[model samples]
Target: MAAQSKIPQATAKRLPLYYRFLNNLQVQGKSRVSSKELSEAVKVDSATIRRDFSYFGALGKKGYGYNVEYLLGFFRKTLDQDETTYVALIGVGNLGTAFLHYNFTKNNNTRIEMAFDADPNKVGQEIGGVPVYHIDDLEERINHVQAAILTVPGAEAQTITERLMESGITGILNFTPARITVPEEVRVHHIDLAVELQSLIYFMKHYPLEIE
Candidate 1:
């Protein structure tokens, strides 16, 4: 595998999609797949898929396409699929509770091991098998956590983000609308659901497809 730093960020993000499709192919008893087939399955263009695979230096043969089991094995190692990633969730509100309940069940590598909330009523209780601790115990409880999911109110987002940084949380999946600031060492991925919906509507209005 090539150094991940050499891969384009967009391409890096699509690797999991490719891996998942390959997994499906393997389960379906399909041994090989072409870039065109992969493109249709993952909704990515064939040329782009080929370019992404080329970053790893000849993952597929020109005439034979790609072997499903081999591609899955390669990506399993690349994505560290065998290792587990523990994540903490902050703010057990509606959105936070939903996260705890779903908890990335499809992905075996990632899980929300614990959750934190300010509400005393919810504290010390378990939701969807994940224990919820008080926000005050965040730093102590998050010592072993590598990442966090921020679902707190927009007003509390920055303050809680600072606390998460202080607790040595390197990655954050921010669900709050607030654009919290972070140091260069820390990574944050914001999922503004409302904004995403609005963007979807905008695209639907302006980029309508013509079906013949």
Candidate 2:
């Protein structure tokens, strides 16, 4: 596996997509795959896929294509699928609860092991088999975990992020609109639903289509 810091963020983001398609190919008993095949399955251009693979050095021959099993093993190690990544949820609201219930089961590498909330009714309870601890225990519980998915309100985003930093959290998947800064070593991935919705609407508005 290449140093994560050395790999470009764009390439890092596409690794999961490549892994998913490769897994499917492996299940189908595919011995090898071409860049074009991966491109089609992942909706990335063949040239782009090839470029991403180049970052890790030549993975396949020009005519032979990529060996499914070889690529699978390489990526499994690259993405750390062989090891489990425990995650904590900072909010146990509706969206947070939904996340806990589903919990990315499709990706066995990751799991939400615990959740935190201020609601008395929700505290000291377990949702989707993950214990819900009080917010005051955020630092303590999160210290036991490596990463977290932040669903707290925007106003509290920075505060919680600071606390998480203090507690030794290394990665954060922030769902809030707020952009909380951290040390360069700490990775924070933001998923703003409102912005995504707006982007979708903007695209559809300009490219309207009629139902057949």
Candidate 3:
């Protein structure tokens, strides 16, 4: 088996999806599951599932399949389900407000512990039980939180990103249209809603699926 660091990033990205489905099976009193069954449930081909599991050694038997409880325990450890990771939200506008109101407690280890915004009216308020602080106080109040959600306007995204990196934030979920720059150690995931919607429409139009 390969070390965790050696696992392909594409395979690692699908780990959470596999974990969630296995969790559901366990709750339904399923004691074991076959690779084919897992493929159907997760929509990944059985061959790809087999290859993904191979990276972590023999997870499932040839005929007996995989033990639900054992697989769940493995995934819990791999995904760090026992420990809680606190995060900060860096905007409080409509999009950011929706994130704060979102319930992230279900099967997730990360929590939004605090928020930041430049608006004086929104400062010192608590939305979804998470406290909001002035953006100027970011470095002072961020504490041990290492990840942040960037929902600030496009113009402010890059400036706030640099500040966040300097203030010890290593990972960012950037929801803004701006393409922020960061050092090699810093990781940023951009989620552009408009572009994604446009891509979906384009794919449906050009690569239409055949019906049975």
Candidate 4:
């Protein structure tokens, strides 16, 4: 835990991307890979990749580069891939329904254990193998779930977030436009698709990125 805490947040965020690419390399029967190779595959610069790997001392050799299987095993342990993380969905709208149909556990060890909705028609119905319950049961049924996906309307985001925090939610992936407040210790990742799309378009028009 102490070691993990010391890693830079930016590097920590990139670890999974590196792990995924390494996993693909192993699947393709590739044994050794250079940082330059990884840079191209994952779209990260070679120098940045070297620096990120430096956080964990001696991950690769000076001349021999990296061993695909060895690096894969190392990242599996570092990312706690052995254990599956349970999550709860707090809405049953269009976006939330699509998320249910997607099998996240196929790539990462994260699964939506259940979903909650205010609509009586959605409640008691199962979508994508995940059971949907009434929103009133949030506290009673959310026990043991570590994280949540907040897909409710912007109006209900704060209310649902308060309820989720009360039930011991550690983190939230908030999809609502409203910025819900949370305690200092609680982590929240806000992903507004509209805002992201606009930002992407603006960057492309104003600052064109060079193609590799």
**Tell me, what's the RMSD of every candidate?**
1.7, 2.8, 1.9, 1.5
Worst ten in a row by lDDT for model 4: 1-10
Best by TM-score: 4
Q: Assess candidate 4 and give its lDDT.
A: 0.90
TM-score of each model, in listed order: 0.93, 0.88, 0.94, 0.95
List candidate 3 stretches off by more than 4 Å. 1-3
- What digit string (tens of lDDT, one per residue) describes model 4 on residues 117-137? 999999999999999999999
lDDT of 3 by residue, 113-180 (tens): 99999999999999999999999999999989979999999999999998998898999999999998
Model 4 stretches astray by more than 4 angstroms: none
Ranking according to lDDT, highest score first: 4, 3, 1, 2
Look at candidate 1 and give me any clashing residue pairs: none
Residue 44, candidate 3: Cα error in Å is 1.0
Local distance difference test scores for all models: 0.89, 0.86, 0.90, 0.90
lDDT at position 97, candidate 4: 98
Kindly report which residue pairs in candidate 3 clash with one another.
none
